[model samples]
Target chain A: MAGGQERILRRRIKSVQATRKITKAMELIAASQIARSQARIAANRPYREGMQRIIREAASADPAAARKMLATPEKVDVAIVLVIVGDRGLSGPYNSSALRAGDRLVHMLQHQGTRVRLFTVGKKAPAFFRFRGLDVEQSFTGFADRPTFADARAVAAALAAPFVAGEVQQVLLVSTRFVSAGSQVVESEQLLPLVMPNDMEVAAPTGLKGYTEFEPEVEQLLTELAPRALESEIFSALLEGAASFHTSQQRAMAAATDNADELGQTLSRIMNRARQDSITTEIMEIVGGAEALRSGK
Target chain B: MASLRVEIVTPESALWTGDATGLMARSSEGQFTILPQHTATVGDVVPGVVRVATSSGEVAFCVHGGYFQVGPGEEPGVTRATVLAGIAERVGDIDVARASRAKETLEAQLASPGDLDDLSRAQLTGALARAELRLRAAQH
Candidate 1:
C-alpha cells in the first residue's frame, strides 16, 4: 500500500494506453491500404488478361514451334528465384513467411546441384537472405507497397536476361498470394517456361481463329509476347503481395491493439487497487493517531 | 448509324469507356481505323495515338504498347473494341511540359550513351517514342 507504487502503476498504464492508440491508428491505415490494393489489382486484370489472350493466340497459331521453344526447356542447370516480401515490418509474418519459403526453395535447388541466382524485391528479402550468408544477385525496393508497371518491367528485364541468354533454365517466384480478404497464403510459382492458361487453350475464339493475322510471324510474336507476359505476371504477383501485406498488417495491428488494451485494463485495475490500499492505509494512520490522542486525553 | 462500345484500359486504370462511332489505332502492321460492325479481330497495338470519334467530338489517347481486340458483342453486328494498353494517358490529362521534358531527357540519354547495352538502349528508345507520342496527342 505504498503511494510510490501506486504512482508507478499509473505511469505504466498511461504508457500502455498510448501504445494502444498507436496500434489502433496503424490498424486503420492498413485496412484502408488493403482496399486500395484490391482496387489496383482489379484495374490491372483486364490488361493482364488481354496480354495472356494475345500470347495464347500466338502460341496456338503454331503450337509446335512456339510451345517447343518457349514453354519448356529440356534440361536444368541455372535457376533464377525471385522472392517478394514487404518493404516495411510490423506486418506479422508476411515478409518472414515468403522469405522462409524462398530460403527453403533455394536450399532445395542447391541440394539438387543446380546453381541458383537469387533476386529479391522489397528491403526485407535482401537483409534476411544476406544475413543467412546467401548471395542476392539483385534487389529492388522502394515501391513494394504500391508497385507500378514500370517497376514490374524493370524487374522482369533483370529476370529475363539470364533466361534469354541461356544462362538460367527456369525462373520461380515466391510471394504471398492474396486469395481473399481473410486468407493469404505463401506460394511459389514458375515464371519462366510460360504455362499457358487452360481456358486460353480450350476456348479459342472460333470466329477469329485463323482470320486474325499477326503482324510478325507467330513464332516472332511469341518471342515478343514472352517478355510482356512475364512483366504482367510479375506485376500481378507484386499487387497480390502488396494486398496480402496490408491485410496481414491490419490483422496484426488489430491483435496488438487488443493486447495493449487488455494490458492497460489489467494495469489500471492494479493501479486502482494500489491507490485504494494507499488511501486505506492513510485513513488508518489518521484514525490511529486520533485514537491515540483521544486515549491520552 | 451503328456505334461500337470502346474501352481503353491500362494497368493503372481504365482511361476511357464509352460508345464511339469510329476509332483509329496504330498496330504493328500499320495504322487502321475501325468503324461500326468491324469484324472480330485482334492486333498488337503500337505506341502512338488512339483516336476515337464519340458523339461529342474526337478524343485522342496516348497509348503504349498493348493489344487491341474487336469482338462481337451481345447484339448482332455490334462489335466491342477494347484497347488494353500497358500505359495510357488521355490527351486532355497530358501535361505538355512534362512530356516535352521527358522526351528531351530521353533523347539526350539516347544520344550520349554509347556505353548503354542494346537492351537498355532499346528500352530508352521505346520510352522516348512514348513520350513523343504523348506530346503529339496533347497538341491535337
Candidate 2:
C-alpha cells in the first residue's frame, strides 16, 4: 500500500512539473508582449495628446458649440455600454474585473430607467452577459491581444452610428487602464459627448485662450473632430488594455509556476517518506521469516 | 533667427519629427504653408501629400485625412507644427506595387457592388482613396 502511494505521488509530481513548464513558457511570452505593448502606447502618445490639444483649442474657442456636442444630455432614453476585455482567459482578474465593472454599469443604467444596448470587444463577454439575460448587440473578437488602429476605428464606427443617428444619446466604456508597469485600474468613463478636456486629468494650461485660429471655424472643426477624437480615444484605450492584459497574465503565470514548484516539492517529499516506509516493512518481513526458520530448525 | 519644428504623427507612431524651414499642406480652406513665426492655427489636413522643407532638402508624406496644429514652441521664436493623421507614411516609403494592386482590387469590388453593407462599402471607398493618394504621392 505504501509503495502504491509512492507511485501515485510520483505521477502527480510529474504532472505538476509539466504544468509548471507550461506556466513558465506562458510567463515568458507575456513578459515579452508587455514591452511591445508598452512601446505601442508610447508611440501613440503624441497622436492622442495632439488630438486632445486640438479638441481643447476648439472647445475653448467656441464653448457654446462645444457644449452642444460635449455636454451631457439631460434626458437619456437609451445608452450604449462598450466593454473591452481580453480574448483569452487565465490572465488573473484582468478580464473579470472589467467585465464586472461593465455589468455593474449596465445595471446602474437600467436602474435609471434607460434602455441599455451592450457591445463587447472580447470573446468572453457575450456569454457572461447573455447568461444574465442581457442582450449583446455586437461583440468584436479575434483581436484583443494585439489591436490595430483599424480595429479601434471599427469599434468607434459601431459606437458612433447610433449616437449620430440619435438612437443612443450616451456611450459609456468599461475597461482597464494601464497606469504603469505595476498598476492597472479598471475604469468606466463616458465615450460620447467627448468628455471635455477641462474635465480630464491633464487639463490644458489654457494658454493663448481665444488666440488660436481655426481654418473652417471652431464649430465646424469640432463637429468634424468629434468622430476622429472618438477613434483616438478608443485606440489609446485598447492599447492600454492590451498592456494591462499582458502584465496581468505574466504575473498570474509566474504565481502559477511558483505554486506548481511548491506542489511538486511537497509531493516528492511525501513520496520519499512513503518509499522509506515500504523498504522498512520489507526488511522487517525478511528478518521475521529468518527468525521463524531458525526456530523451526 | 526664427526656427520651425515639424512633427508628423499617426496613431501608430510619429512618422517624422525634425527642424524644418517650412511645412506645406492643403487644408479644407485652401493650400497653406507654415513657416517660422506663423500664427497659431488649427485645421484639418486633406488626404494628400504633405511636404516639409528642411535646410538640406525636402521630404514628402502621403497623409490620409488628418489634422494639423501650428503654435508656439517651448523656446521663444520656435514655431511647432504638429500633424496628426490616422494613417500616414513617407512618400518614399510607399509601395507602388502594393498600392496599385490594392487600387485595382478596390475598383473591381466597387464595380461589382454586391450585397456589401454600407459600412464595408464606405471602408472600401476610404481604402481606395488612401491607395490612390499613395500612388499619386509616390509618382513625384
Candidate 3:
C-alpha cells in the first residue's frame, strides 16, 4: 500500500471515532426521549379510546343527525392533506417514508384532477415538497418531536378550515403510526368533519342491552362532540409520530455507533499488521549483517 | 337500591373513578343529575364543573367538553363520562409561576392581532381559561 494509504486510514479512524462519539451521545439522548414519548402516548390513550367510543355510540344513537358529519366519501374535488413528520432528520427513513408517502398521495390526487392543498407538520415536509415543486399551503415545524395538544388543535383547525369554507371536499392526514417498539407504518387518514370509527369496535364488546337518551337532541351533541373527536384523533396521531421519531433516531444512532466500532477495529488490525511487517524486516536485516560480519572476521 | 359508578377520564389521565351517590353535570340540553337507579341517558358534556358526591366527600372537576352514558337497567348505577381536557386536581398542585406563564402566553396570543389563526387562538384562549379557573378554584 502507498504511504498515503496509511495516512488516509489514520484520518478515517479519527473521523470514525468522532462520529462514534456523536452517535453515542445521540443514542443516549433519543433513548431517554423514548420513555417520555411512550408515557405521553400512554397518557393520551384513554382519552382517544374514550373519544372513539363516545363518537361511535353517539353516531349509533342518532344515525340521522350524524349523517352530515359522518360521511362516506363519494367524490373528491379538493383534498386538504396534513403531513406529520420530524423537523430534523438523522432518523433513517423516518422522514423519507413520510415524505415519500405524502408525495405519492399528492401525485395520485393530482392525477385524478383533485386539487391538493397541503398542510405540513414537522420541519422536513416543507423542504421535501418544495424540492418536488409542490406547493405547501401551510407548514408547522418543531412540534413533531415533542408535540402538545395545542399543536394538534392548530393542525386540526387548519385542516378543518378549507372543509368548512367548501374549498375542500375531503381532509386527509398523512402520518407515521406506531404499532410497537419495532414496528411503525405511515398511513393517511381522513381528518375532517369527524367521520365515525367502524361499528365493530364501538358496539361495546359486552352486548348487554343499553339505551341512552339525549335531552337537547342528537344534532347539538354532535356539534360539540365532533370537534373534540377530531382534536383527540390529531393528538393521538402526533403522539404516535413522536414515539416513532424517537425510536427511529435511537435505532439509527445505534447502527452508526456499531459501524464506527467495526471501522475502528479494522483500522487497528491493519496498523498492527503493518507494525509486525516492519519489525520482521528489521530483524531479518540485523541477522544478515551479523552473519556477514562473522564470516568476514 | 344501588349506587352509581362514575368515571371522569381526561386525556392526560383518568381523573376520577369511583362509586358515587349522585352527580350533576352540565349537559348540552341543560344540567342533568344522576342518582341511584336513574334513567339511562347519554348526552353531551358542556364546558363546566361536574359535582360528584362520593364517600370521601363532594368534589368538583372542570371539564372542557365530552359525553356521558348512564344506564337504564338495574345494573346498579353505571355512569361513565370522559373528557379529553379536564382538571381532576386543582391548581393547588400547580406552581403559581408556571400556571401564570400558561395564562400569559394564552392572553398574549388572544390579544395579538392575528398572529395565530383563529382556531389556535381559540385553543390558547380555552387553555388559558381553564388555567384561570384552576387558579381561582385554588384560592378558595
Candidate 4:
C-alpha cells in the first residue's frame, strides 16, 4: 500500500516539474519582451513631446478658439468608453485591472443617467464584459502585444466619429499607464474634448508667448490638429500598455515557477518518508519469524 | 553664432536629427524655408518631400501630412525645428518597388465596382497619395 502511495507521489512530482518548465520558459520570454517594449516607448517620446508642445503653442495663441475644443462638456448625453488590455492571459492583473476600471466607469456614467457605449482593444475584454450583460459596441483584437501607428489611427477614427457627429459628447479611456519598470497603475481619463496639458508639465515657451505664427491661423490649425493629436495619444497609450503587460507577465510567471519548486520539494519529502516506513516494517517481520523458529526447536 | 537644429520625428521613432543650415518644406500657405535664427512658427506640412540642408549635403524625407514647430532651443542662439509626422521615412530608404506595388493595388481597389465605406475610401486615397509621394521622392 505504501509503495502504491509512493508511485502516485512520483507521478505528481513529474507533472509539477513539467509545469515548472513551462513557467520558467514563459518567464524568460516575457523578460525579453520587456526590454523591447521599453525601447519602443523610448523611441516614441520625441514625437509625443513634440505634439504636446505644438498643442500648447496653438492653445496659447488663441485662447478663445482653444476653449471651445478643450473645455469639458457640461452634460454628456452619450459617452463612449474605450478599454485597452492585453490579448493574452497569464499577465497577472494587467488585463483585469483595466477592465474593472472601465466597468466601474461605465456604471458611474450610467448612474448619472448618461448612455454608455463600450469599446475594447483586446480579445480578452469582449467575453468578460458580455458575461456581465454589457453589450460591446466594437472590439479590436490581435494587436495588444505590439500596436502600430495604423492601429492607433483606426481606433482614433472610430472614437472620433461619434464625438464629431454630436452623437457622443464624451470619450473616456481606461488603460494601464507604465509609470516605470517597477510601477504601473490603471487610470481612466477623458479622450475627447482634449485635455490641455497643465502649465507645470508643459515646458515654458522658448521666448515671448503668443509670438508664434500659424500658417492657416490658430483656429483652423487646432481644428485639423485634433484628430492627429488623438492618434498620437492613443499610440503612446498602446505602447505603454504593451510594456506594462510584459512586465506583469514576467513577474507572474516567475512566481509560478517558485511555487512549483516548493510543491515538488514537499511532495518528495513525503515520498521519501513513506519508503523508510515500508523498509522498517519488513525488517521487523523478519526478526519475528527467526524468533519463532528458535523457540520451536 | 547662431545655429539650426532639425529633427524629423514620426510616431514610431525619430527619423533624423542633427545640425542643419536650413529646412525646407511646403505648407498649406506655400513653400517655406527656415534658416538659423528663424522666428517661432507652428504650422501644418502637406504631404511632400522635406529637405534639410546640412554642411555636407541635402537630405530628403517623405513626410505624410504632419506638423512642424520652429522655436528657440534650450540654449541661446540655437533655433530648433521639429517636424512631427504620423508617417515619414528618409527618401533614400524608400523601397520604390514596394511603393509602386502599393500604388497599383490601391488604384485597383479604388477602380473596382465594389462598394466601399466613405472611411475606407478616404483611407485608400490617403495611402495612394503616400505611395505616390514616396515614389516621387525616391526619383529625385
Candidate 5:
C-alpha cells in the first residue's frame, strides 16, 4: 500500500510539472504577441492620423453642410450595436468584459424604447449573447487576432448600409480600448453620424486648416470621406483589441504559471511528507516484527 | 522659389518626402498639376501614377486612391503638398511583371460575362485600375 501511494504521488507530480510547462510556454507566446500587436498599432497610427486630418479639414470646410450629414437623428427607432471580441479566448476578462459592456448597452438602448440590432465581430460575442437568449443579427469571425484593412472595410460596409438605408438611426461600437501597455478598458462609443474630431482626439492643424479647395463641394467631399473614416476607425479599434487581448492573455498566463508553480511545490511537499510517513510506517512494522520474534524466543 | 515640399504617405509608411518643382496627379475631375503656392487645394486622387519633379530628378509613385492636400508652409513662399494614399509604391519598387499579370487577370475577370454584384464589380474595377497604374508606373 505504501509503495502504491508513492507511485501515485510521483505520477501526480509529473502531471503537474507537464501542465506548468504548457502554461510557461503560453505565457511566453502571449508576451511576444503583445509586443507584436503593439508595434502594429504604432505603425497604423500614421495613416489613421492622416485620414482624420483630411476628414477634419473637409468637414470644417463648410460646417453647415457637413453638419447636415453629420447630425445624429433625434429619434432613434432602431440602433445597431457592434460588439468586437476575440475569436479564441483564454485572455482573462478581455472577451467577457467587452460582452458585458455590450450587453449593458443593448439593455440600456432597449430600455429607451429603441430596437437594438446586434452585430458581433469575433467568435466569442455571438455565442455568448445567443447563450443568453439574445439574437445576433450578424457575426463576423476569423480575423480577431490579426485584423486587416479589408476586414475593417467589410465591417464598415455592414455598418454603413443600415445607416445609409435609414434603418439604423444610431450605431454603437463596443470593444476593448488599448489606452496604453499598462492599461486597457472595455468601452462602447458611437460610430455613426460622423462625429467631428475634437481638439482632444486630434491635434488642431495649424494655420488655414481647411484652406482646402474641395474638388466638388464640401458636402460631396464629406459624403465620400465618411466611409473611409469609418474604416480607419474600425481598423484602429481592431488593432487595439488585438493588443489588449494579447496583454490580458499574457497576464493571465503568467498568473496561471505562477499558480502552477505554487501548486506543484505544495504537491511536492505533500508527497515528500507522505513518503516520509510511509517510510516511518515501514520502519515501525519492521521493529514490531523484530520485537514479536524476540518475545516469541 | 518654385520648389514645393512634397510628401507622399501611405497607411504603412511615408514613401517619399522632398522638395519638388511640381507635382502631378489625377482626380475624378481630371489630371491636375501643383506648383508652389498653389491655392490650398484638396482633392481625391485616383489610382494612377503621381509624378513629382524635384531638383534632384523626377520621381513617380503608383498611388491607389486617396486624398491629396496642399497648403501654405512656414516659409514665405514655400508650400506643402501631402498625398495620403491607401497604398503607394515607389516607381522603382513596383513589380512590373506581377502588376501586368494582375492587370491581365483582372481584365479577364471583368470581361467574363457573369452577373457580379455591385460591390464585387466595384472592387474588381478598383483592383484592375490599381494594377494598370502600377504597371504603367513600372514601365515608365
Candidate 6:
C-alpha cells in the first residue's frame, strides 16, 4: 500500500514541474505584450487631442450649423448599443464585467420604454448572451486583439445608421477604459451627436492655441467636426482597451507563475519523501530474508 | 504674412507648418478658398488637392478630408487659423513598391469577392486611397 502511494506522489511531481514551465513562459510573453500596448496608447493621444480641438472649433463657429448636425430626437423609441469585450478567457473578469454591465444597461433602457438593440464586438459575447436567452443583432470576432480604424468605423456606422435615419434616438458604447498601469475600469460612453462639453476645448494643450482665423464661417466648420469627434472617441477607446487587456494579462500570468512555483516545491518535497520510504522498505525485506535463512541452518 | 497658418498632420506625424498666399480646399459644400484675414468659419473636407499659394510659388498636396479650424480663439481681425489636416502625406513620403503591393493584394481580394461585405469594401477603398495618395504625391 505504501509503495503504491509513493509511486503516485512521484508522478504528481513531474506533472507539476511541467506546468511551471508553461506558466513561466506565459508570464514572459504577457510582459512583452504590455510594452507594445502601452506604446500604441501613447502614440494615439495626439490624434485624439487634435480631433477634439477641431470639434470644439467647429461647434463654436456655428452653434446653429452644429445644431443641424447634432440634432437630438425628442423621444428615443429605439436605441443601438455597441458592446466591446475580449475574445478569449483567462484574463480575470474583463469580458464578464463588460457583459454584465451591458446586460444591466439594456435592462434599464428597456424599463424606460426604449427598445434596446445590441451589437457585440468580441467572440466571447455571442455565446454568453445566447446562453442567457438574449438576442444579438451582430457579433464580430477576430478583431478584438488588434482593432483597426476600419473595425471601429464598421461598428460606428451600425450605431449611426439608426440614429441618422431616426431609427435610434441615441447610441452608446460600452468598453473598458485603461486608467493607469495598475487599474482599468469599464466605461459606457455616448458615441453619436456628441454632447459638446463646455470648457474642454478652451483647455486645449499644444494646440495652435493663440491663432487661427476662419475664412468662410464658423457654423460651416463645426459641421465637419462632429463626425471626426466620434471617430476620435472610438479610436481612443480601442487603444485604451488594448492597453488594459495586456496589463491584466500580465498580472494574471505573474500570479499563475508564482502559484505554479509553489505547487512545484510541494511536489518536490513529496517526491523526496516517497523515494526514502521505498528504499527503507527494500532494506527491511532483505534483512528479514537473511534472518529466516539463519534460523533454518 | 499670408494669414492661413496652414498646419498639416498625418496619423504618423506632423508634415508641414508654413504660410501660404491663398488656400483652396475641398469642403462638403464645394471647393472653398481661404484668404488672409478671412472670416471665422469651419468646413468638412473631401479628398482632393490642397493648393497653397506661397510667396515663391504654389505647392499642392493630395489631401484626405479632415477638419479645418479658422480664428479659433483670435478676436476676428487677427487671423489665426489652424487646419487640423488628417493623414496628410508628401508624395515622396510613401514607398511606391509597398503601396503598389498593397493595392495588388486589395484588388485580388476584391476580385475573389470573399465576404466583400461593407466591412471588406471599406477596407479595399482605404487601401486604394492610400495607394493613390502615394502614387500621386510621389510622382512630382
lDDT of each: 0.86, 0.93, 0.78, 0.93, 0.85, 0.70
Task: Please give the TM-score of chain B in predicted model 3.
Answer: 0.75
For every model shown, the clashing-pair count is 0, 0, 1, 0, 0, 24
Q: What DockQ do the predictions score, one after another?
A: 0.57, 0.84, 0.54, 0.84, 0.53, 0.29
Better of 3 and 6 by TM-score: 3
In angstroms, the error of model 5 at B10 is 2.9
Model 3 stretches astray by more than 4 angstroms: A1-8, A200-210, A286-297, B71-77, B84-91, B94-128
Candidate 5 local lDDT, residue B44:
88
The regions of model 1 sitting more than 4 angstroms off are A199-210, B1-3, B36-40, B74-76, B105-125
Which portions of model 2 miss their true places by more than 4 Å? A200-205
Scored against the true structure, residue A202 in model 1 reaches a CA lDDT of 71
Q: Is candidate 2 or candidate 6 better by TM-score?
A: 2
After best superposition, candidate 2 residue A173: deviation in angstroms? 0.7
Residue A209 miss distance in model 4 (angstroms): 3.6
Which CAPRI category fits model 1?
Answer: medium
Evaluate model 5: give its TM-score.
0.91
- Candidate 5: residue A33 Cα off by (Å): 1.7
TM-score of chain B of each: 0.86, 0.98, 0.75, 0.98, 0.82, 0.77
Task: Report lDDT (Cα) of residue A24, candidate 6.
Answer: 72
Q: For model 1, name the residue pairs that clash.
A: none
Displacement of residue A18 (Cα, Å) in model 5 is: 2.1
> What are the per-residue Cα lDDT tens digits for candidate 5 across B1-140?
55599989865567787899999999888999999879887778888889999887899888888888788776878888888877788888988888889988999999999999999999999888888778777876
**Candidate 3, pairs of clashing residues:** A87-A123
**Candidate 4 lDDT, tens digit per residue, B8-125?**
9999999999999999999999999999999899999999999999999999999988999999998999999999999999998999999999999999999998899988899999
Model 6 DockQ class: acceptable
Best of the two (2, 3) by lDDT: 2
